[model samples]
Target: MLAVLLVTSCTSSSASGEQGDDAKPRSTSSARPAPPRKPVALTIAPGDRAAGVEPGAPVTIAAVDGKVTQVLVVNEAGQPVAGVLSPDATTWQTTEPLGFGKTYTATATGRGTDGKDATVTSVFSTAAPRVKADLSMNPLDGQVVGVGQPLAFYFDAPVANKAAAQQAIQVHSEPAAEGAFYWYSDKEVHWRPKEYWAAGTRITINASIYGRDFGNGVYGNDSRTAVVTVGDAVVANADGATHQMTVTVNGAVVRTIPISMGKPGHETPVGTYVVMSEHTDYTMDSSTYGVPADAANGYRTTVAVASRMSNSGIFYHSAPWSVGDQGHRNVSHGCINMTTENARWLQSISNKGDVIVVQNSGGPVLESWDGLGDWQVPWDQWAAGGKK
Candidate 1:
């Protein structure tokens, strides 16, 4: 019995040794902890909150050491918006449009291989359209005007409330001259002292047209400024009876040209006009003025060196065909008929602000076509024409 017990014990010992020898080697006794979590960073570009920006702006967020798991933008209500996560889990992005004129918040989260997690957040606001008026003055703020020059302002949108817009506009100068703003149209406004600006006087304009609704849905952009130096005044007088138009620089006669007045029916107007525009070889026709051509009332077309006399169809234009009647006869419809060479001469000497006076003619006045001239209406009157 003792021998049998000894054999069983030996068999048990041998089995235990075989199992120990077949086992794999163990380099580490326990599993390693995951890498430390990465730090998350969120960045917002264009820090301005008042600038008008459209939706779907691009945004990005990233983690330094770990993988980015998620990134999202939310409104005040904390709703999830469009966002993205990088393949390496180290970055996130929002690729969708955002709401305008609203505040938004962004959040980013990341996880590292070390079984650690990280998170970050940021806030920003979008631009919203506000109510108010802004005016932008041209020729630069605090500029000087040369002699016989006028101050002008341009509006981006057509104004229905010309009176309101004009009322908000003001001008200041060293001599404190009386100036008036005339609405040429919904988009253009010009200010002129009763006469030309005083020489060496500093002039300024204050315009507040922002956020104020012009007709339709348009609004003013912002306030603007302008300053200029005034120089010597120049004038030009044209007499239909004498068939002579004289140009005076600083009240001195510099140039004189023999001119022909308009014909009986289509007479040139009598008025004070500035040198509005000058061109060579301008086309003239009664059709442009809405006058139909027929046997009695209609007329054929004519071309000349067209110097625009008024917003109306009148021009100190070239009429080579009327040269024979220049000094002795009124042969043109309403233009100050001149030779091409003479018109070219005038064009060389004329400028935008020079004045022209047409006298002794049975025709419309400057104000007759002032509507076409559109630049003469007062600012108060212009504001009254707005929709609101």
Candidate 2:
């Protein structure tokens, strides 16, 4: 009985060994192959489901181990956002900034070297602006102005980002007026052509500031436009040494009149100027121009036929007291003094932007910022001032 049991045990052991060997071969042959790996991957910036993103933040989509095939970005209204694809077609980014408190979606597709495709979609929202600035323009719509008139903008609030603010404003002219924008102050900016505007030229300014960020949580409220038409060229040439004033219309000398300029200590400024305003009767105050009324050579008198030619209290007005000096010698406080009849006639024919060139004066040249002295700046310097 013991011998029989031993033989049976041996047979069972052999059978178990055979089964183990067979199972090992079956497991090796029937094991599932590893899942195929993806050939391309896409990544969207700001990530999917992002919130409170800055409106000026850049939005981009990039491909990995592949090239971008297509990309589309749209706002909540389904309007497509403008963007540019990379030259190699590996990435895409938005061109303009997004609006505040707005939701945007981006979808991108890419193809791998293995001929497989991959896609990704992202959604995000921009934060609302805490402060906003509004802008207004001068020259009024459809107004006819003189060649020396400047295109100016006034901001309701001070702009910290002057570069960005200037970028939002664009100026265009019919015959291509080359100009530059000069920031006179925090809230004011002015633009003037390299030279005076050609007669009958059309000027337009487009201020696309809406949705533009100006730093420190400040954004632009709305956009604006200003259009102006240039009229005939009226120029006045004054010779301080000869005490003569010549008026020209479209390059033709229309009239010449005797005039008296500044005395020795109060010589007139030489350079180009523009007529700012006209007044049938105006009071001349020495205090207004920084000269105290109690000081020597200071006078406060009311006069007829006055035309404001500068911000520093300079004018072309009647000064009958100095009639003997007219056309003979320069003797007056610092103005172009003429007969009442001639002053009235000149005032009647001149408009707000007429050019006035003062030559052969003893004083320094007029400053470019002194009441429409933009013509005093050279074209190269003016253009360089606008470089970003």
Candidate 3:
């Protein structure tokens, strides 16, 4: 009877401790927190954002969540430049040649693959500068121009590569004069023969640039060549002492005119000057060239056929005031004063680039010194600045 009572008590304790089926802890489902969403931010610098950066140029990109995992650069036409990646992957660089004045774009993409953040996209630009340039002749087949003219090439942009440009530029003539280019500046270039080109000679210039790069993704497009037929060389001699000038064409004296030169102290230059311009009835004001117009310090007159020799105020024009001294004596400022008929004749004989030599003068040579700019520098000195 005691054992049966103990067994009944143990069974009751087990029943109370064991939870009922309905009282079991409810297993409610809670949604797992969605993965953190990616933030959107893409920032690039060097606002002219593109590709084809200069050698050793710096490129930087900014993004949120450090999502910038990749960057790409394409050319102006949306072509990729080769080897545009650094080993560290911090920057994008180009090992190949980038053109000049070209356009490109850099793209950056970031992904939240770590599953802790979001993705991002960024775009930037970098440009290479036009350092070395080549100026070749257009019309590879070749054409012809005036006999007196050289193969003239006007650069579309300033060139930093003087030697390359010079090397790429070639001149072919029936009889080569061993031509050389004289760079007036990054903007202007002039080529000439060791001497004046042979009259009636055919000259050609070839500017070959197909795969060549000028920097800034500005690749030289098609090759070009300019052809010209050389004309008779015109040479004029203006003697200040004799108060006379002799004009020659193709080694023949075509015209001679009596003229008045500058006075003893204010003489004209004695050297070779090119006929830069021509005009009829040009005003002569001392004030324009820093000469006062007072009777004691100025010269005021209206001359004809104002052919400019230099940037100075000197010219070969009609001088009615010095008619008495014309062809006989040298008296006046630094100018060649002639009669209206002689001045007109000079116009007929003179051509652009025609030589005008003034001899036996006491004053300075009217060599484009005042406003001539870089052209005033001697040829040898001018070409010395070129980078090989």
Candidate 4:
């Protein structure tokens, strides 16, 4: 009986040990649940760390399976690049062209359907230009000019892509004027309305050519703006046959001065012209106009109240020596000879761009490319010359 009890106790103890082992807890530290995934994907053009990008290249940022919340693009100078975002908020793109040799940074934020946010960043640089073209404008900013004034641009280098160059310039005028740009040569262009600009017109020119490529390793250097105000319309009518000049301000005759024009061989040109410049005193030298001082018809003298009417050295000036021929016959070289008082009065009232019309002259008609004689070109011809 003692041996049976001992064996039984040993069995019970073994069973109890087994039970204890089975009841003990097992560790779950090695097993874990996976993390949630990002809901949005971001893409940027001219991708991160990109180089040698074109200035006019497109810049864009887009989000997939999500909506774009914010985007910011800036240059090294910290100026914000102008851009527009789609209404659905999926993409954003730049509006204006970028500058050459500039480093730009872009940052974007997006939100996913799961309410998670994603942010992305990119840095890039534009290619530098080997050559650059600079612009020089006429009728400079903030000046009040006459009706016949034209907006002119002179490029430092010849532009091979005339159409592209013309597209870079924009003009806006208050009171609404219809105009077109005419290329006089590869390096020069001018813009004018079909008729003279209306008095009280306000004009603005935006030359947004920076970064524009003009073939042959040339690019635009910078952008510019010009604002001009139009003053009264001062028009002068000169009759070579009658030898009289009628000056009018806004269609009302202001002065009728007896004048002497060019002689038979050196007759003044017919057609319209603009007053390019004025001087209180100017030296009229025959040599300046390719006429030798020793020639029979050549004369050199300094005169007061000289107003340049053409690029060919024609002027309306005070000529006391020709007083006898005034109002009767055409005398002197290809200039309007008038009394000192009349010439001074005309200069005092006339501003740059005033209209001067010479008629019934036995001379060649004015050429369109001659000294701001833009009106000489018909409206249809001028419009055809623009970016077609």
Best by TM-score: 4
Clashing pairs in 2: none
User: In model 2, where do residues sit more than 4 Å from their true spots?
Assistant: 1-131, 156-160, 185-187, 386-388
lDDT of 4 at 177: 96
lDDT of 1 by residue, 1-388 (tens): 1121211121122555554534544333444564444444434342324244333345567666566776667888888777666676656666665664667777666666555667666677654544333444544654433444566566655667677667656778888886666655666776666656555667766664544345344445554655555545556788888888887777788778888988898777777766556676555766766776654665765555676756556777777787888888787767688888888776665555556777887767668225233234444653343233
Candidate 1, superposed: residue stretches over 4 Å from native: 1-164, 167-176, 183-188, 198-208, 212-218, 222-232, 292-304, 368-388
Best candidate (score: lDDT): 4
Candidate lDDT scores, in order, read 0.62, 0.82, 0.60, 0.86
Model 1, residue 252: distance off in Å is: 0.8
Candidate 4 lDDT trough over 10 residues, lowest sum: 1-10
Error of 4 at 345 (Å): 0.9
Report the Cα lDDT for residue 381, model 4: 90
TM-scores, all models, native as reference = 0.53, 0.67, 0.55, 0.79
Can you tell me which runs of candidate 3 are displaced by over 4 Å? 1-160, 184-188, 205-229, 292-296, 365-388
For model 3, state the Cα shift of residue 354 in Å.
0.7
Between the candidate structures 2 and 4, which one is better when assessed by TM-score?
4
Q: Write the per-residue lDDT of candidate 3 for residues 1-388, one digit (tens) a residue.
A: 1122211111222466874445533344445555555553545543453444332233455555435566665766878756444454344444554455555565666444343433333334334433444344322243332223333455566665556556656788888676567655564566666566677777776776433445444444455666666556777788876767888888888888888888887788766666656788787888877878885868777776688766777778887878999989888778788888888877775555566777876666554333222234455764464222
